[model samples]
Target: MRITVGKWFQGGSPWVWLNAGAVAISLVMVVGLLALIAVRGLGHFWPSAIVAADYRVPGQESRQVLGQLADSETVSGERLRGAGLPLDPSLDVVERSLIKVGNRDVTGSDFAWVVEPWLQDAHYPENVMAVERREWGNFYGYLKAVREADKTVATGDQAWEVFQQRIARALAIHDQIYQIEKHDIGSINARLERLRLKERGLELKGNATPAVLAGIQAERAALDAEYKVLEQQLGKLYVAFNRDSAVAETADGQEVILSMGKVVRAYQPNAMGLVDKLAFYGDKLWEFVSDDPREANTEGGIFPAIFGTVMMVILMSIIVTPFGVIAAVYLREYAGQGFMTRSIRIAVNNLAGVPSIVYGVFGLGFFVYFLGGQMDQLFFPAALPAPTFGTPGLMWAAITLALLTLPVVIVATEEGLSRIPRSVREGSLALGATKAETLWRVVLPMASPAMMTGLILAVARAAGEVAPLMLVGVVKLAPSLPLDGNYPFLHLDQKFMHLGFHIYDVGFQSPNVEAARPLVYATALLLVIVIAVLNLSAVAIRNSLREKYKTLEV
Candidate 1:
């Protein structure tokens, strides 16, 4: 048996099996992790039933609790007693539930923990509504009435219908207001700023004449006229939207009037059938991916973060590929394989192992501070003190990440170039092709797939990096996207949001921990999906290239 095992090891069969097992284990773990995240995160958007129950804690007042049951657990009775809660000596364990009692404006918190023994008369009422708001997370209450500027337009069950109709109107009006303010007014602001820069440029050149000044003034007047018209339209819409309100009664019988404009969506989760809940889930998921974040990023969506992440990765790929390829070509194709070349390779390998935060620090000092400051002084002297390019923004961030992942690309490209047969290069050179021409057509085409492999790895790393981005550019909330309906639409100097940083901020930095936890899981899963999709795209391109050039290999 020992001889047989030794022979197996010598044949490399055992090692192959061991390596396959390791890869299998890794694949299983990755799938399991993604499954866990999807279950925890995607489940959050499904409309859960709201329960109204009576609770009586020992030596405390008998009161009503109304909320969604968020979680449940069984704990030792001794722990409860140790925490100063009165408990029976005979009871070894007790069950408790965490309920999402979301009337934060009134209760000061969005969640409550209620012991099962003290809870009674639990019921799911069809009229119970879950209100997603703009300011205070979520509101759970019974719709009592719907009003139009003090006059009750809907009462009891009828109010529910009225509420939905008017809220839809309010949302439409709000969208219009958003477009005008962000798109139209935003354009005017950009034009005005450009005019200021132009004036400053002319002044610097000693050419600030009266006629030139008059032209700038005339353009300003035209923009202001448009702004006034949009402003007046916005004011009227605001009045129209604010005219409607709803009076909702809490479980404690306290009635409060809420504006329709503040509510994002209202749904009766308990009353919704499986089909209804599924539809609601789909809509919520779409909104989460398609809309901008609101309420300190704890409430609405993360479309901006998604857009910023993809945009940054593309920009990084574009900036890094050429530089990395050129470096690799020089080292592998032209330079002699001597001690210096070996030392440079060792340095690049060491760079890959350096901590990511070190790259962030370097980017801040070198890219944002040094190079940007010089560019600002030379080209944008007119916009001084404000620090245009001298600030953390999109272009600097892309360049910083390019530098951070440069080693990976260089290594991959070098490997690919090394794999190409030397005889192929000789054959091309002997057939009337110069060395440069042979490299550009024969070698490069065959090696294009390897360059893509490097890009795939670089993109996978860059998309998930949050540290370097924090210093170079990612923000918690970017009011405007880097690209918009403005001049030079792709504004490389604008600050942007990132999905990885969004996850970090919501998961750790948020003030509302319990409320943010679900979002954290959801955002994390989304980030993973985004990276996977990006990798798959690059992989597809690489596969196509490899297939096309397969005949050249033999």
Candidate 2:
């Protein structure tokens, strides 16, 4: 012990040091990737601007600028009104003015204006205010303002105002329609019920019921005729309300038609006032999450994607856990050693190695075609040719992923089950517990930590998966959420958007590759962060369970 240091140095090995260094480097790479994703993905939630062409008269040009408008202040004899503040006339009064282009006025007029700061490398006519600087509440506030403006223009001020009034009217109308529809539905149901009852009655009588059957047939015909009329009326109302129309008035009080683009520009955010920049970003970030989907990119928010991801993961977990656990239990507790068990083990291990794209093919063929086709035929006869189950949807995607990750969960759970001391099972049985009771109450609980570890691994894999989901359910754009207002509203057969596929589409399929590259990175970062968060949560749960079961240590 006194002289061991010199002998150890003489027998030094470089391989050990090299191995340690490699491990350190690997850890650093992983941590760096995580940091990059968190920073970049979170950054996109903040506000940024895109410069586009401004085309109009040589003296008057129009450009699109995004940001919120500054608060309005009215000057009254050297005092500011509307903002509850007194004006300092001596302080530089920055008066913002927009030229009346094509008979458009600043007040009560929706005209597109580009902020001064956003103008770069673009020529502006001598008379045109190509760039102007104004204050907006935040990026999201700016977006909201634009949306309101778009709606106002598309329907015409009078019409749009009328439409707003009509939205309430529409709700009332909807209720009325629902009542009428309900009545019709009830009538149809009653007729069908009567037909069924008469059929049953005729069977009981057994003597003959041509008259009763004829009466039933007449009732059916009347119901069908009434339903057709109601359907036609409903269709007409839907069309009348759904048509897009906008009104714009010229400076001379002449009105003209406007497109969604025109109205959006006219109603763009007014940036006239400045406030705290940090608060602006913070507010904008919140808005990004809360806003509605826009026409092209669905500008209001990413809420749908967030919702979809959470829903898919939860569903996939629900599907995978029981199946994986049960498989593990059977292999560990019930299955006897033999060629069959060994073959089953090999198949499970091989399943983990198969490329996920293959699973997509399997999902599309089996789940989307075979199983779904059978379901559609058996239950949804009225929805014929629509292929409810045959379409790519969240349910199928979840099931596909559950299958894809099943092997991992099974292997991990089996390992965990194997590690539990046999004595625990024996003890439970000795205390008068049945095999099922011992497994469920004692063995399963003891193995839960390991099971969770497997689940965490599965979640991380599934959360980042894009290949299978693409074939099964992921869409480039979805107009409405999977869960919405309709009969059996949570339509699992409908295609849905996913962050992983969004990254792929933006990176590869986008028209503006350069513009979308940053977005791709941002999305990738988001996916990584989501997976990390899930894994971290699982880790926390595992730690808690481990602590709870610490006394059961082998």
Candidate 3:
């Protein structure tokens, strides 16, 4: 039996199969892309053996090089020769490997591409040290000796054991220093600034009388005394932190002295067993997520970015939901079904199609320049020269995103409201319920699932948006989170970090492209996971709402 194409289309089987094929292809592509990103990004944290090899290219000197093999690729000789490199005419293809030669101060670059044909006698040495740093990225070399100032503490075979011990002590001290500076002293500094602002405000109000001044002075004195104690402790810590230095020799045999506090952690990747390597990898991954970024944000963790992203999304959701729901209820329940209402609905639908960057521009001009400026002029007169709300910060970012996604919420809610049977509303009215009561009690409950759906879509769109955030509140590095332990714990006026902006900054604005590429993928993967989590939470709520209202709707 020959099945004609028209007959198959008429039977709807062709359309069903066609849709299934499209969905399958989409899933495969999305999964494949995510897998690729995961492999490239997550694999960067894993410990790889550092290869020490003598590399020579034709007439070049045979100098030894040491680095982790970063990547490999095949290149046609024609392409190589086009770039002014001499290659054999007979060579059709040549394999090359990129080695992450990580002594940046010594080599001036973290990576170097070496032709595979020119490398010889490659081996992994157990004694080679890979030192993760607080400043210079990573240092890969052989530890020559352990020293304190000019005095050599340990050398020869004893250097490794002694180096390990002193490094552990140095790291412990570094942690203490970090805690005091960032948390303890940081809190003090914040309080001191608040006190200064308070004094300024009092003086402006003509209330800085002698007694008030005296009381403020007394408080300042107490804070100063406390600061001095913290300062002395910090001074002692710095002395301890910088006292221990290790002498390491690069593959080129030049000795480099690295201060102990500068080193984050050091290990011999080449000598680690599978279990040890896995442990190290786990530790590094945790640090990446939990630690604050250092070294121009190419290294370390992204906790600040994560926190800011989630906070902004939540704030946006809070601001948008009520406004959207109210508008939708009025339009669907109370508004006359006339030309004017239809026009307003069309305008709202059109808003969903507006470019995101346009919203960013509108936010910057209206919210930041106009509204924020007025706020600073009115409420923050003492802080005139330095703008308070008259700057891009968390609140404005949230508000801007709320406005951008309002249309989506309104449309979803209206559709949900329309889906509720007129009979239900009539029944409520017939039961002597007021119109407001029907909307509040009966109408909204059925439409709650649709509101959740809108929120999920809104979050998915807003979470990944970078352009608007860049203009409003997103920054490469935020010194403090929007919410903190300070009074008015949720500091809505503070500028914030964001994962989407971090991806953009790392991928494009970073000084080192090759080094930042993996970070980009990792950050991208993190963003996808965050959006998924948010959507799943909304979905769970939506499912529960649907279940609860199922009988009511029927």
Candidate 4:
């Protein structure tokens, strides 16, 4: 089957095959990574259990019958049975008795054995049993029931009535407590305000009369005493809220049932149960999306890292875009061809290749220590002892990333400026446009797509960066947001958390690694999505601009 072929295709084909192989390998690597991430991240949301039950059925049966029923005497049709009197045609006798089934460890009991009359028609008959033999099913349900029953026996309407009455009484007590505390605080504040006013009056009169001064001093002392009492009372209320007795109420006006201890115990089993495990992870994922910045880690949600990451990226973009574009414009269009310009171009390219960690160190030294120190010495002598600019903060992090990604923007923008046809510039100059005017209107609009592309790359790089930000501004945990109620509220000097740092911290540095693994994967997925969205948006803008200017022939 040999056939003649062209000389070019007949020999030295190994290089072509090698190039194809390399491309295939790269595609496999990228696709494999995406597949792995998608599987692990999405698997967390899938249901992992067969059955779930809370064991708090409102209409639970109080009685349970065990053992088989006794046989009944049967009637014969006009015939006598051996060793007995003649059987009647219509007479019949049955034996029945009530019995109690003792509680047992039915972990291995069959589904049929644990079935009660009410549970026979359950959707998942195997899962709805009161006592599960298998450890795989929702064991936590049974445990919760056991714990809840120990705390309270009433069920259904009876339980609801008891709960309502208790809540009402607790509310009444809380209202009384709040009113008393408010009145005491108000009185103390009023007295303090009056004392301050009197002192001002004395100053205005230019007469520090002994009686007036004494009156002011006495009022101040009284206000302090009252405030102390109010604080003490408030402390007591806080203690009460923490204690079980605060929510406890007597069913018969004689015996109080304390629920705080019981409720906490009951919650433990439910938390350990399979259904609760699913719910817990679900909530964790939800928290990653919906959490507000005000919540702490202990409160089940927080979004400070998300907010800080966005703010830092925006600040970096603002600082880098203009500087990079201008530098690119100067290098590509204005700068004459010379050894000096060529050398500078090489240096700028090399800067982009430098390790980000090194940039972080440079930023810490130059921006934080040198520039910040100079500013502090020149402008803030009264606040001299405290360091402001020298501290690691949001501003420093942004500036550091801006520098790190500057070369990328510069290279991209320069390529864009180079792409515009030479005739366009000649025509602008022919029309009496100056160099600045050409750059501003004609050159910039044409080069915008390239600039946007550079900005997109810079943003993508800066957003995922963890190591540099860690050294410069990112904190493991930030107590307050960078923007707050303080004077000149947007405090760039304040340290902030980032999602990338959070991923690193929770994955490697967490106290409970096993418990935090899912959270780590979820956070990593979120970071990827955020970066992808930012890049996609920039790409869209670039495309839109390209389409708008498509009709303008080069």
- Computed on alpha carbons, the lDDT of every model, listed in order, comes to 0.92, 0.63, 0.91, 0.63
lDDT of 1 by residue, 65-98 (tens): 9999888999999999999887887889999999
TM-score of each: 0.98, 0.62, 0.97, 0.62
Compared with the true structure, what per-residue lDDT tens digits does model 4 show for residues 13-64?
A: 7679889999999999978877777676555443333222122212453322
Alpha-carbon RMSD to native, per candidate: 1.2, 12.7, 1.4, 16.4
List pairs with backbone clashes in candidate 1: none
For 243-338, candidate 2 gives per-residue lDDT tens digits of 443343322234443322212112121221234335555665565455433423323345666667767887898899999999999998999978
> Poorest 10 consecutive residues of model 4 by lDDT?
129-138
Model 1's TM-score against the true structure: 0.98
TM-score of 2: 0.62
Candidate 2, which ten residues in sequence have the lowest lDDT sum? Answer: 136-145
For candidate 4, the TM-score is 0.62
